[model samples]
Target: MSFVLLVTLTVIEIVLLVLVLAIMVTMVTRQLRSIAANLARVAFGVRAVETQVSAIGPGVTEVNRLLRDINGTLPRVAQRAEQLAR
Candidate 1:
């Protein structure tokens, strides 16, 4: 009789432990998925910034080249105009 009682109690304890462990594992997996989703969002933002920067490159290059050309000839042109006026 005592042996039967001990066996039943041990089985009940094992069942409760398994239930608690299962709940804990489920909670951990859910948190990990949430973290992964947040990281994916951050990666998407970085890619968008990269694409926008690349899109602006051609316009920026054109502006820089235009400034360089104007700078190289504007002073000489101004001197020629002054000489002609005099």
Candidate 2:
């Protein structure tokens, strides 16, 4: 009788452990899907930022070129102004 009772209890414990593991697997799968979706959204956002930066690149280069041209002319203009004053 004691042996029968021990066997029954052991079977029940195994069944419960299996149920717990199934539940844990289901929960982990759900969380992984959510994490994947979030990562995809982040990837999309990063791509958008990259596109905007690319679009700005030529405009920024043009502005820098203009600034360099103006910087090159400033000393000549100042020298002319001083000559006029003299």
Candidate 3:
């Protein structure tokens, strides 16, 4: 009789431990899914920003060229102004 009671208690303890482990696994799985969804959204936003930056590249290059042209003429203009001052 004593042996039978001991076996029953051991089985109950094992069942409770398995139940607790299952709950923990389910909670972890839910959190992982949420993180995956947020990461996907972030990836989409990054791609959109990349597309916009690519579209602006040619305009930026044109502006830089214009600035370079102005920069090249500045020294001659300054020299002329100095001559006029004299």
Model 2 clash pairs are none
Clashes of 1: 0
> Which portions of model 2 miss their true places by more than 4 Å?
62-86
Global lDDT of each candidate = 0.98, 0.98, 0.98
Q: Candidate 3, 56: how far from true, in Å?
A: 2.3
lDDT per residue for candidate 1 within 1-86, as digits (tens), equals: 69999999999999999999999999999999999999999999999999989989999999999999999999999999999999
In model 1, the clashing pairs are none
> lDDT by residue for model 2 over 1-86, one digit each (tens)?
69999999999999999999999999999999999999999999999999889988989989999999999999999999999999
lDDT for model 3 comes to 0.98
